[model samples]
Target: MSTPQNLKLPIPDVLASAICAANRLIQRLAQPWLVQLVLRLAIAVPFWKSGILKWHGFLQLSDTAIDLFTQEFQLHLPGGPYPFPAPAVVAFLSACGEVTFPVLLVLGFGTRFAAAGLILMTCIIELTVPDGWPIHLTWVAMALAIAAWGPGRVSIDYLLGDRNARW
Candidate 1:
């Protein structure tokens, strides 16, 4: 058999192959675990900050916190001229929710449940603060993404085999 000639690829073909390889490399670099970790952190930060602010005075109620719940976040009932007042209770519950759920999310324990709670919290905030829908929608989208995609393999839930627990 005659010796085979060395085959040479065209310059454009080589460039195209390089580009394709780079595209695949980028896609591989965007690992699901890393993405989930980012999502968890991104969505958790705001809630954690809000929670920390609200719970600054753990045992005692701060006047500023009270004022926000009473004045800014009051729920008006149609029944009476006076409202069904539970500002302190609502504020405490909300603060607890924000803190607890975000911690769970960041830890990747019960991520889906945490995301759902955040979604509910977002809904309440939207209803109460309609003007802030844009911000709330962003929060909702992040939470929804977590809820939909789950915590991935980097999570405690994955270790515990609960990563698929979207409820």
Candidate 2:
């Protein structure tokens, strides 16, 4: 068989390809993915630690735990179904949720679920609890962003692929 001639790329094709590759690289670098990860991790780690404290304290604050939480922030929750409105189950659940959610969020696994919980909790906190009324709202904003934009490239969400995507 005759050997095929060596292929040569036209100058225009080479230049165009180079420009396209460069543009792609720049776009990746300019993405706010890193910033999102940093922010999520920053909030998640601290939230997880504090949740540990709440978890341990759950036994002592069995009754009116919700009240105590609201009190810690100097606020109150309205009447509602709260695991019988006693035993502080809601408080325990809340603490565990915060801890668990951050872990999921940081790892990018079940990010949607984590974000949803955060949004719900923060909304309640904003509406019912805290001297700092805006604290919950702030978290809510962050949660909304997480929900809307999703975790960045380094997240478990990326690795798990669309099969795990909420959308």
Candidate 3:
């Protein structure tokens, strides 16, 4: 393809030198650990706190729980069930998942799948339960980052050579 005369370069060396400099700059800026750290902190704090509350027997804070817990806020799921089941253990498991997933995410361990699970749960809370928009947003963003970037050099996934491996 012929270059447009107006766009033609007078000196290809200038372009080549610029390109090389840009490449070096990119490598210097490629701090995967920093990116992962941001992902861990921004995503995990709320999750860990919320999950810890539930783990401490707070029960599911879903629509049913909201209505029951605070009369000030009327709540309904329309077709939703409570966060907890009759067995109690199911709720416990959910709590543990929420609690532990954040820890794993913070540590960048199996980040993608962990983030994916948490993201699914958050989407359920946001879409089905309708009370966790911000939290869901946090999870969705971080989960996506984890899935997109994999864990960083600071992560167990990286140390174990699973950074590029998918769940």
Candidate 4:
């Protein structure tokens, strides 16, 4: 088969050279460790802040949290002795997971598991609060990227010699 001429595009020589230079620059500067560190911090903050709030709520046994769970976040349990258990329990568990997993992620210990947990939590949140999919989806994407790509070089995962390897 002959090469398709249509595939070729006409461009200014300066623009093409600039694009090539940019690509090379990116190749040089885009280190895995730096990117992963950023991703780790970026994803961790939201979970960390939220987890702290939940932990505080758990400590205080906040009425607002209970109300939020009972009215807004009450997950419907299927076919059980009790129709629904205490919302506080669910909130507490979620808070623990959020706090623990994100810390693990930030530390790069159990990085994949932490990212996976966050991903699951993101899914649950997405399902529960469908209206907030845009924000949640971004979280999901970041989690998946971290989960799949690993925590990068500056992480415990790297020091533990599990950067390129999957759990």
Candidate 5:
């Protein structure tokens, strides 16, 4: 039996060179800044859409939003599926966070803060809709990645000379 590290496959020189060139091209196209921008947009769009639906006008919560929280949503605790405390307040706060955090993420301003907020929101959402864990887990993963990576270059955080900004 050969050790994994000791096993190697021979390749034609032309094939090797082509592979190297393709890798270089891919690396050039997939810059960290671009990847971060895409991640930001991907996570932001869903929340933004949901937030928009919750509002009828500026600062005005839709009846549907309030109704969902009051009648439909519940916290799936160990003992019971509990109704949300102060359902109106919870709905308003959720709507506000869903809108505000995503905008901050897209702008890459206070990126870590925005990501953290999203993570918190996702957890709450998971508790409210336990069956939606698959989607919530994706949101948490993206938020965690953004928080860990911070805003890459080409972001407002980078433009403002944040010391921790990724290059």
Candidate 6:
């Protein structure tokens, strides 16, 4: 039997060069600024959509949003699934956070703060719907990544010379 090291087949010169070229192309396309921008947009969209749905007009929480918080959502914690305290207040705050944080994220203004807000929101969402952990975990991961990295160069933070400052 051939050992693992001896079992490898050699790549053809043309194939090796093609792979290198592809890697170089990918590196060029996936710049840090572009990756950061995409991350900001990707994470912002869902929150923004949810936020807009919650509002009937400026500062107005829709009946559906209020009703959902009061009737449907709960904190699935130890010993009991607790109803959200002050559901109206919670719903209004949630709506505001969902709206405001996404705009900050997309603009890359207060990007880390926005990401941290999203992280907090994700944690609350996880408590509310334990079954949605898969998606919630993804949101947390994106938010944490943004928080750790800060917004990249294509951002208001960068333009204002505040990019390096921890928000």
Locate the minimum summed-lDDT window of 10 residues in model 3. 66-75
The 10 consecutive residues of candidate 6 with the worst lDDT sum are 158-167
What local distance difference test score does each model get? 0.82, 0.68, 0.68, 0.78, 0.91, 0.92
Over 81-142, each residue of candidate 2 has an lDDT whose tens digit, in order, gives: 23234325657777778788999988888877788887787766554445656666667777
User: How far is each candidate from the true structure, as Cα RMSD in Å?
Assistant: 6.3, 11.4, 7.0, 6.1, 5.6, 4.6
What lDDT tens digits, residue by residue, belong to model 3 across residues 1-167? 66686586658989899999999998887667777778777888877776676532455445433333334222245664444333244445556777888888878787778888887777655744566677677678878887787877788888888757343
Error of 5 at 47 (Å): 0.4
| TM-score (C-alpha) between model 2 and the true structure | 0.62
Q: Better model by TM-score, 1 or 5? A: 5
Indicate the residue-level lDDT of 155 in model 2.
87
Q: Which ten residues in a row have the lowest lDDT in candidate 2?
A: 80-89
Q: Write the per-residue lDDT of candidate 5 for residues 121-159, one digit (tens) a residue.
A: 999999999999999999999888788777888689988
Sort order, lDDT high to low: 6, 5, 1, 4, 3, 2
TM per model? Answer: 0.78, 0.62, 0.61, 0.77, 0.86, 0.90
Q: Which stretches of candidate 4 lie over 4 Å from their true place?
A: 1-11, 57-61, 74-84, 165-167
Alpha carbon deviation, residue 22, candidate 1 (Å):
4.5
Stretches of candidate 6 exceeding 4 Å from the true structure: 1-11, 165-167
Over 1-167, each residue of candidate 4 has an lDDT whose tens digit, in order, gives 55786565657877899999999999888877777788888999998887777644335545665566667774433442232257778777677887898899888999999999999888777656668889998998888889888988878888988858343
Per-residue alpha-carbon lDDT of candidate 1 for residues 84-166, written as tens digits (9 for 90 to 100): 26988877878888899989998999999999999999988776666888999999998998988899888899999855634
Task: Point out where model 1 deviates above 4 Å.
Answer: 1-22, 74-84, 163-167
